[model samples]
Every structure is written in structure tokens, then in C-alpha cells.
Target chain A: GAGVSQTPSNKVTEKGKYVELRCDPISGHTALYWYRQSLGQGPEFLIYFQGTGAADDSGLPNDRFFAVRPEGSVSTLKIQRTERGDSAVYLCASSLWGTSTGELFFGEGSRLTVL
Target chain B: GESVGLHLPTLSVQEGDNSIINCAYSNSASDYFIWYKQESGKGPQFIIDIRSNMDKRQGQRVTVLLNKTVKHLSLQIAATQPGDSAVYFCAENGAESKLTFGKGITLSVRP
Candidate 1:
């Protein structure tokens, strides 16, 4: 796809279970980001990857949330011991540069529901 | 901690009228700001962006104004259309590469 693509558009899991969400950015994009959005709120920065390295993961709520962009193309966000509070829409975006100074192309996002 | 926030949760304007959405940021070091529009069940699309160096930037039917003195940002849509009805968010980028977004404001255009 010419745009960002995210898999598992909807994921419902029980509390304490683990989940993984995938994101495929536009070809040739060097920068990728992950954000979490709860109901009625905007996306909160989660992590940022420049190429194969995570330049910043300061936004990760805790050690349980982790993301990786291997080969600098496809990325995955992993969550462990999912809690009800973790239920939200996880959005992935990519840009040509590793900075927020430019426009970012975003995916449709993955909606996670914890029960 | 830095935070971005919108002035209001919702704004209603008549079709063909101009609409303005306001946002405020607590970080004084932010240098870049962006506005994004999100429709139902869709990801946010970029609208326009302004740097702290410039006070205003204009796009197709959209204008973004930034005030560094007060740390305020406003997005103006000329001649609001039904298609313009969506949730709008203002984001700020500081020294870090990541962007911090505020709670969005829902714009409703009434015909």
C-alpha cells in the first residue's frame, strides 16, 4: 500500500494476556512513531524509531510496552500483561525524516480492547 | 512536564462561515506546531504547520496562526463546509523528534 498499513484493526484480549500489533510504513520512510489514544483524547506519543534503532522511547508508559522496527520497514508494538487501562487505539505514523518538523503519514490504527 | 490543550471541546459554525479552533501549550521551548484533522474511524491527516519563527502559515482554505508570546495556536478554516466537520488537534514539537498532541476539538458545521 502507498500509505501506512496496520494489522489487526480490532483486537480484544483478556486482562493479563499479551498482544502484538503490526505496522507497515510507506516504502522508503526513515522515521516511524507509535502513539496511544484513549476515548475523546488525542494521540499521546509512545515511541519513535529512526531506521533500525529506537531514537526515543520516553513515551512508553512502562517496561511492558515495547516497539521495534526491524529492517527499518515493518514495526511491531508489543504489550504484556494487558490491563483494562491499556485499551485504546494505537496509531503508527511514518515520515521521510526523523523529525516532527515535517508531515507524518499515519495508518488507520489498531483498536485494542482489554476485558 | 509539557502539555498541550484545547480551549474548548466543541465548536459549531454555519456552513460558509469561518471557524476557529484554539489551542494552548505549556512548553515555552516548543519550536514547531502542527494541526491535524481526523474523521470518523480514520487516522489523522495533516492540515498545516507553523514554526515559532513564523507567526502564521496558510494552506488550502486553512490558516494556522501561532503566538509565541502566549503559547497559543489557532487554526482557521475559511468557509466551513460539511466535509470539514471533524475532530481537530494541535500538536507541538519541542527539542525531541516526537510530537505531543492535545485533546482535540470537534468542529460541527451546520447547514
Candidate 2:
């Protein structure tokens, strides 16, 4: 893909339901990241991946939020037993390399509304 | 606990005027800082970035200034336009390649 791609642009799920958001990073990009943005706030870091390994997951918030990138290209963010407070836009980004100096290319984001 | 914050929550400027947005980060270890612009119903787009070694960097009609002594970062937009109306965010590269972002400042350009 020319840029980062995300699926399920919008999702409305009931409380306690499980939902998954997908992201397809640009070809040959080795670094992928996930972020969540609440209303009137900036994007918060959720997780970061270097290749197929999760280099960091400290910002996942809780045990209910999980993400995976098995192939080093596509990633998925899975939320279990979703709560109303979890309503936000989930964003995905990719970089040519997982370096601090590289700029991240962002996707359109998946808006999840937990009702 | 290191965190990033903005001095102002919102800023209103006239079109064609220069606009400046400020942000402060607590981490001194951060070596890179980036500014992003996010419009309604869209994701954040990269505006500009400055490295710790450089105090300033410039792009097309935009400039980013970094003050490592105070851990402050700022973005300047020249000749602001209506299209520049969006929420501006400052992010600092933290441990493990994570970018910690500030709350953001909403910039409104009035015609």
C-alpha cells in the first residue's frame, strides 16, 4: 500500500463485546504502531512493533487491550470486554524503520464506539 | 512520570497571520520531537520534526523550534490559511520508539 491502511472505519459495539481492528502497513516497512485518540485529545500510544515482535506494549492501558503483528506487515488490535470508556479512534502508523528519527505514516483510523 | 503538555488548549488566528503553538515535555532523554496536524474525521499528519542536536528546522511554510534547556517545543505557521485550521499536536520520542503526545492545541483560522 502507498500508505498505512486500516479496516472497519467505524464500529459500534455493546458493552462487554469483543472487537478487533486491523491495520495494513506500507510494504517493506518494518515498524508499526498503534495509538488511541479520545475526543478533544491527542493520540495516545498503545503499542509499537519492530518487525513481527512487539518492542513495546507499556501503553496498552490494561489487560483487555491486545495487539498482534504476526507477519511484520499487518497488525490487529483486539479489545475484549469493551467498556464505554473505550470509545475512541484507534490509529495505526508505520515507518520505513523502527527508529526514533523516522517519521510515522498514519492511517485513516478506526473509530470504535462502545455503547 | 514524564509527560507532554501544551500551554494553550486553543488558538484563534486571522488568515494570513503567523501562528505559533507551544508544547512542553518533561523528559530530557527524548532526542526527537515532531509536530502533527489533525483535521476533523482524519488522522494526524506529520508537519515537521526537530532533532535534539538541532534547535530549529523548517519546512514548507512551517518551522519547528526546540528548546532542550526548557524541554519546550513550538511550531510556527506562516501566512496561516483556513486549511490550517486543525488540532496541532507535539510528540516526543520516548523509550522503545514510542512517541508521547501532548493534549493538543486547536487552531482556528478566521477569514
Candidate 3:
């Protein structure tokens, strides 16, 4: 793809339900990132993947939030027992090499609304 | 805990006028900085980036100024157009390859 792509542009789920958001990064890009953005705020780091392994997951917030990139190209973010506080936009980004320069390309993002 | 934050919450500029948005960061160890623009229902797009080694960088109609002494960053947009209306964010790359972002500022370009 020309740019990073994300699925389920908008998802409204009841509290305690499980939801998954997917991201397809640009072809040949090896670094992937997941971020969460609440209304009126900037994107917050969630997880970062260098290839199929998670290089960092310190920003996951809790055990309910998890992400994986099994093939290194596409990634998925899963939330278990979603809470109303989880309502926000989940963003995905990719970089050619690493985030050394902070120049990662971002996707449209998936809006999750936990009702 | 180091963090980045905007000086203001909103900036309104007239079409054809110049616009400047300011940001402040607390971390002195940050080596890289980037400016991102986000429109409604879309993700953030990179505008310009400046390394700690450089004080300034310029793009098509945008310029980023970095002042490490005070940990301040600013984005300047020339001849702002209606299409330029969007939210702008300043991000800093810190430890662990993580980019910490500040709360965005809304840029409103009046016609």
C-alpha cells in the first residue's frame, strides 16, 4: 500500500466487550507502532513492533490491551473487557527503518467507542 | 516524567496571513523533533522535522524552529490558506524510540 492502512474506521461496542483493530503498514516497512488518541489530545504511544516481535509495549496501559504483528507487515490491537474509558481513536504508523528521527507515517486510525 | 505541551489551545489566522504555533518540552535529552498536521477524521501527517543539532528546518510553506535552551519549538506557516485549517502537534523522540506528543492546537484559517 502507498500508506499505512487501518480497518474498522469506527467501532461502537458495549462495555466489557472485546474488540480488535487492524493495521496494514506500507510495503517493505519494518517498524510499526500503535497509538491511542483521546478527543482534543495528541496520539499516545501504545506499542511498537520491529518486525514480528514487539520491541516495546510499555504504553499498553494495562493487561486488557494487547497487540501483535505476527507477519511483520500487518498488526492487530486487541482490547479485552473494554471499558468506557477506552473510547478513543486507535492509530497505527510505520517507518522504513526505526523511529530514530520520529518520521513515522500514520494511518487513518480506527475509532473505538465503548458504550 | 518528561512531557511536551502546547503553549496555547487554539490559533486563528486570516487567509494569506502567517501563522505561528508554539510548543514546550521538558526533556533536554530529546534529540529529534517533528511537527504533524491532522485533519478531521484523519491521522496525523508529518509536516517538518528538526534535529537537536539544527535550530531550524523549512518545507514548502512550513518552517520549524527549535530552541533547545528553553526547550521550545514552533511551527510557522506562510500565507495560510483555508485548507490549512487543522490541528497541529509537536512531538519529541525520547528514550526507547518513543515519540511523545503534546496536546494539539487547533489552527483556524479564516477566509
Candidate 4:
């Protein structure tokens, strides 16, 4: 894709149901990240992947949140047993690797609405 | 608990006037700071970024100032326009590598 692509621009799922958000990063971007933003708060980091390895997953709120970037290209964010509190905008970003200062390119974001 | 925050959650500016948004970050090891502008129904767009080594950086009509003494960051918009009305977020790239954003400041430009 020309830029980072996120699937399901909006998702409305019932509480307790599972949901998966997918991200296709820019070509050759070795670092991918997931973030969650509530109604009035800043986006909080969920996970980050360096190539196919998750270098950091410390920001995952609980065990229900897990993300994987297999093959080092596309990544998926899985939410198990979603709760009403899990509803928020899920943002996906990608950047070149090796440097921490590389600017991140963001996708349109998946707006998850857990009813 | 380290946190980044905006001094004001919202600010209103007159058209063609200059606007200033302030932010405070608690991390001393932060190497990079960035400002992002997000409009309704859109993703965040990068405005400008500044590294801790440099106290100031400028972009198109925007300037970012970093003050290490107080761990503060400020975004100054020259001649604010209507299109500049959006939520601005300040993110700090701490030793953690990824960016930790501050609670956003909404910029409202009144004509």
C-alpha cells in the first residue's frame, strides 16, 4: 500500500464479542505500532513490533489485548472478550526502523464501538 | 507515573492571529518530541518534531520549542488560519522508543 492501511474504518461489536483490527504498513517499514484512544484522551500505545518480533508490549492494558506482526509486513490486533470499556479508536502507525526519530505514518484508524 | 499534559485543553484564536499551545512532559530521557494535528474523522497528521538536543525547530508556519529545564514543549502557529482548527497533540519519545502523547489541545480559529 502507498501508506499504512487499516481495515474496517469503523467496527461496532457487541460486548463480549471478539474483534480483530488489521494493519498493512507502508512498504518496507520495519516498525509497526498500535494505539488506543478514548473519547477525550490521547492515544495510548498498545504494542510495537520491530520486524516480526514484538520489541515492546508493555502498554497492553490486559491479557485480552494481543498484537502480532507475522512475516514483518502486516499486523493484527486481537481483542478477546471485548468489553464496553474497550471501545475506542484504534490507531495503526508505521515507520522506518533503526532510528527512534523516524516520523510515523498513521492510518485512518479503526473506530471500534463496543455496544 | 510519568505523564505529558497540555496546559489548556482548548484555545480560541482569531483568524490571522498567532496561537500558542503549551505542553509539559515529565520524562527527562525523552529524545524526540512531535506535534500532531487531527481533524474530525481523520487520522493524526504530523506537524513538526524536535529533538531534545535542539531547543527549537521550524516548519511551514509552525515552530516547535523544547525547554529541557522544565520539560516543556510549545507549538507556535504564525497567522493562524481556519484550517488550523483541530486538536493538537504533543507526543514525547521517551527512552521507551514509542511516542507517548499528551492530552490534546483543541485549536479553534474564529473568523
Candidate 5:
């Protein structure tokens, strides 16, 4: 894709349900990142992937949240036992490089609502 | 823990006026800073960025100023327009490779 792409733009699931959000980064981008944005707040870092490996996962809120980048291009953010507090806009970003100074390109994001 | 923060939650400016948004970061080691603009229902878009080595940077109609001594950063937009109404966020790169973001400020442009 020319830009980052996210799937399941909006999802409403019951508590305890499992959900998976997908992200397709721009072609040739080696750095992928996931973030969560709550109402009236900026996007919070969730995880970062350098190539096929996760370089950072400390920002993930809890064990219920997990992400994987199997091919180093497409990534999936999985949530187990969803809670109402998990509701937020999940954003995916990709950068040409994994360097600290690289600018990130973002997607529209997937809004998850746990009822 | 150190983090990036904004001074105001919201700011209103008349169309065609200049707008300034301020941010403060606590980490003294942070070397990079960026500003983002997010519209309703859309993801954040990069506006401008500045490095610790430089105090100022300019884009098409935007400017980013960094004051490392005071840990302050600001984004200045010239000729504010209705299309510029959005939430603005500031982010800084600390010891880690990830960028830490501030809560963000809503910019309302009045015609």
C-alpha cells in the first residue's frame, strides 16, 4: 500500500471477547508501531516492531494486549478478555527506518468499543 | 516518570491570526521533538520537528521552536484557517526509540 492501512475501522464487542486489529504498513517500511488514543487524549505508545521482531512492548497496558509482526510488513494487535476500559482508537504507524529521528506515517485507525 | 505535557487543553484563535501551541518535556536527554495535527476521526499528521542541536525550524507555514534549557517546545502556525482546527500534539524521543506524546491541545479557529 502507498500508506499505512488498518482494518476493522470500527469494532464493538462484548466483554471477555477476543478481537484482532490488522495493520498493513507502507511498502519497504521497516518500522511499525501501534498506539492507543483515548477520548480527548493524544496517542499512547503500545508497541513497536523493528522488522519481524518487537523492539519495544513496555507501553502495552496489560497482558490482555498483544501484537505480532510475522512478515515485518503486516501486523496484528490482539486483545484477549476485552474490557470497557480497552475502548479506544488503535493507531498503526510505519516509518522508512527504525531510527529515532525517523518520521512516522499513520493510518486512520481502528476504533474498538468493548461493551 | 518523565513525560511531555502541554500548557493548555484548548485554544481559540480568529481566522487569519497566528497561533502558538506550547509544550514542556521533562527528560533532559531527549534529542528529538515533533508536532502532530489530528482532525476529528483521523489519525495524527506530522506538522514539523526540531532537533536538540537547533533551536528553531520552519516549514511551509509552520515553525517549531525548541528551548532545551527550559525543556520547552512550541509550534507556531501563520494565518490560522478553519482547516487548521484540530488537536495538536507534541512528542519527544527519550532514551528509548519510541516517541512519548503529550495529552494534546484542541485548536479552534473562529471565522
Candidate 6:
């Protein structure tokens, strides 16, 4: 079975520009999550979706960051006005169940560079 | 938006030695803890997980020890090899469904 997959392995954009990153979760996974990883640091939670609605998004850093999962399988993280600080790897993961107790399968991730 | 964090920034161990990484979490209600290994240019890979109920759980060559009283967690790897070099992060999920992660410890293997 295919693991989680993300598109545009690398993306470079100017500051203040808008961009979107996509995620395709594993089949039969009812839970999906988004995280941000900075250099020499750990991944910070962004948001999580259970089915078609976001179950938890309190981790989102600010209003500039937003995510959506319309059909319950794939998701997209959108940035309204990118900043240099927003440059990092955007990771997407999914699990068999919706709870945090289950193990997660992660994608390689999409590296976003804002200059 | 506080989260779990690591006690040590880095650890350097020789091949065939044992390595222990520590993490401290603030949320006591966090019953679930997970250890993830992330290599350069890749996303985090699940290494092992332990619930608050049990004090210890073992995997292939890795073990997770959780102490709810101190709100601390540790990952022990026996006979550490060069391939085990990577960044280790501990995540805790409390009553909240979100899994907050630690600062991470970089493991360097000296062969």
C-alpha cells in the first residue's frame, strides 16, 4: 500500500506571495495531521483533520495559515502571505484511526522556501 | 502553544554503545507518548510508542520509559549502531487530540 504522499517536493516563492501544499493520506486512514519543521528543531503541530472536518487546529501559528480537507482523503495547507519565517518543511501524516494513540504514516514532506 | 521539549540538545555515542534520550512534557493529562526518528532530508519515522499506563515498552532494539510522576520520558537504544544516527523527538498527546512534539535530540554515532 502507498504511504502518505505530498506534491511539489520543493517550492520557492517570494515573500508575501501565496502558496498551497497538498497531501494525500494513506487509504483507509480516518485521521490526518499537518506539522511544520524548522532547521535544527522539532516538528510543531499545525492542525489535524478527522474525516472531513478539522478536529484540532489550535496548533496553527497564526491566521495566515489555514488548512482544509474537503473530501476526507486529501488535504491542502494554504498560506495567505508567506514570510521568510514560514520557510520550512511542511509534513503531512495519517493514521488508521482518529486518535493520537495510533501510529502515523508520514510523507517525505514539501520543503517551502520563502525569500 | 507550549509543547514537549528535550533535556539534551545532542548526544554522541560510539558504535555498539547504548544511548538514552530524554524529554520533558508539561501536560500531565497526556496519556500517550511516541518516539520518532528523523533523518536528514526526510520526515519523522515512528520508532516506538508508550502509553501512560505502562512504565516501559520495548521494540526491536529500542525501549521507551515513561514516568508520569516527573512528566519525563526516555528512549533507550541498546547496541547503538551508526545507522541509528538521527534526530529523536518525543511527542505527547493529552486530553486534547493534538500531538505536541519536543525540541528533539540529535544523535551522532561515532564509528
Cα lDDT tens digits for candidate 5, A1-115: 6888999999999999999999999999999999999999889999999999999999999999999999888999999999999999999999988537678999999999999
lDDT of 5 by residue, B1-111 (tens): 998999999999999999999999999999999999999999899998888999999998899999988999999999999999999999998866698899999999999
lDDT of each: 0.94, 0.93, 0.94, 0.92, 0.94, 0.91
Q: List the residue pairs that clash in candidate 1.
A: none
Q: Candidate 3 vs candidate 4: which has greater lDDT?
A: 3
Question: Predicted chain A of model 1: TM-score relative to the true chain A?
Answer: 0.97
Predicted candidate 4 versus true structure: per-residue lDDT over A11-112, tens digit per residue: 999999999999999999999989999987888998889999999999999999999888999999999999999999999999897227578888989999
The true-versus-predicted C-alpha distance at residue A9 of model 4, in Å, is: 0.8
CA error at residue A43 for candidate 2, angstroms: 1.0
Taking all chains together, each candidate's TM-score versus the true structure is 0.98, 0.97, 0.98, 0.97, 0.98, 0.96
Q: Give the DockQ (C-alpha) for candidate 4.
A: 0.67
Residue lDDT tens for model 3, A30-54: 9999999999999999999999999
Docking class of 2: medium
Alpha-carbon shift of residue A105 in model 2 (angstroms): 0.8
Per-residue error (Å), model 6, residue B106: 0.7
Instruction: Kindly report the fnat of each predicted structure, to 2 decimals.
Output: 0.89, 0.76, 0.87, 0.62, 0.78, 0.69
- What number of clashing residue pairs does each candidate have, in the order they appear? 0, 0, 0, 0, 0, 0
Span of ten consecutive residues with least summed lDDT in model 1 chain A: A98-107
Model 5 residue runs over 4 Å out of place are none
| Model 2's TM-score against the true structure | 0.97
Task: Label model 1 with its docking quality class.
Answer: high
Superposed Cα deviation of residue B107, candidate 5 (Å): 0.7
**Distance from true position, residue B28, model 2, in Å?**
0.9
Q: Which of the numbered candidates is closest to the native, going by highest DockQ?
A: 3
- When just chain B is superposed on the true chain B, each candidate scores a TM-score of 0.98, 0.98, 0.98, 0.97, 0.98, 0.96
- A-chain TM-score of every model: 0.97, 0.98, 0.97, 0.96, 0.97, 0.96
RMSD of each: 0.8, 1.0, 0.8, 1.1, 0.9, 1.3
